[model samples]
Target: MSENLWEHRPESGYVTGTDLAGYRVEAIDGHIGKVDKHTAEADGANIIVDTGVWIFGKEILLPAGCISAVDHPNGTVFLNRTKEDVKGAPEFHRDHHTEAPDYRLTLGDYYSGRVL
Candidate 1:
């Protein structure tokens, strides 16, 4: 796990694999709508932003690179963007969003096709 995803460092590199159940990824300064689930690639090198348990919910994507750091004491996963930025980026949709063009432009470039 450690070898795959790099740990979130301010002036350093990426963060490593996260403790899936013990983390709460936030939109820098936004309210959390419960984390629905996580999907890891690179054999767990990175995780995908799942959907929220609430209705009118949409799926999200979190690249390991975007992770700023992990706060072990509170079990929180920190992201490096504001709420507006996150929502505006590309709202994840299971069907349409996963299409070829969408993947290449949005998530594919974001992830660099690698988990980390």
Candidate 2:
């Protein structure tokens, strides 16, 4: 598979919709948090998880391509990554980072590096 979905879009198997918010997010090791927001655009898609109290209310964005599956019956979104991997991701700043020029590139690089 391609390292990054932005480079070569593929079947990510992630169910996308506006109802994804509030869904529980699960890493390989354990539960991380809940989906605070999501975007399902033609160019790309991702979920912003609000890790309240876990990491001081930090929010992390995970590419939709990284999603392994969605268990609607259980209201959980499963990821192909581990907790440590997500923890090491670049901190998401809803204010200025979203408009930063390097935001997309940084996310691509960080996720691509973990594909192996």
Candidate 3:
């Protein structure tokens, strides 16, 4: 996985300290869901999307690197990934999704194209 996979790109329009909760998450294909939670840690930024009925309410974690842009004005976050990409990610485990290194690696690998 890439070293910067967890850091938002400079051009992604994500301002540090910005609260992304509730922002609509849009994949390359279409709307996926809303942001249930987010983190802005310098080395561990990411978003947890609540997929609602689209995937039986499954929540998926996406690395900041997948974000192509953040439209705060419209309350939407654009991702470079497709809907299938987000859908195929590991399911969010509320208990260990945040602090688990293995979980992060799995996510990073999935998003970085290292894992199929």
Candidate 4:
């Protein structure tokens, strides 16, 4: 039980969008998928990004610590992670929001890729 690596402080917004629900996760690299939902907790946020977002392109998880900022412009919410590392992230599911051990391990593995 430790502090979350990333938190949407009252002073900040973890994810910004013209309309949270309107945001569609366009495929990572010409693929087709969009985030469906997300849940943030002390451990981290479980993002239900469209499974398609895990395509053979960019668009991957952002370790809580790697997040330098969250920007929403032109109806898109953008993250700062590089396209290469993002492409290498483990497969993510948009339906696994229950937060389980395997998910946590996958998340940890995700963080490992954040800074590399």
Worst 10 residues of 2 by lDDT: 1-10
Candidate of highest lDDT? 3
What is the lDDT of every predicted structure here? Answer: 0.49, 0.75, 0.87, 0.45
RMSD of 3: 2.2
Residues 10-93, candidate 1: write the lDDT tens digits.
432333444455367675785444334444444333334543642246666555555666665766666665665556545576
Error of 2 at 35 (Å): 0.2
Task: Give per-residue CA lDDT, model 3, range 20-95, as digits (tens).
Answer: 9999999889999999999989889999889999999988888888988999999999998888888888878867
Task: Supply the TM-score for candidate 1.
Answer: 0.56
For model 3, what is the error of residue 70's alpha carbon versus the real structure, in angstroms, after optimal superposition? Answer: 0.3
lDDT of 4 by residue, 1-116 (tens): 11344444332245532233334443223323344554555556534445442464323444344333344464343444454455666655435624456766776656554543
Pairs in clash, predicted candidate 3: none
How far residue 58's Cα lies from its native spot in candidate 3, in Å, is 0.9
Rank all candidate structures by their lDDT, best first, as comma-separated numbers: 3, 2, 1, 4
TM-score of each: 0.56, 0.83, 0.92, 0.52
Candidate 2 is scored at a TM of 0.83
Compare candidates 2 and 3 on TM-score and give the better one: 3
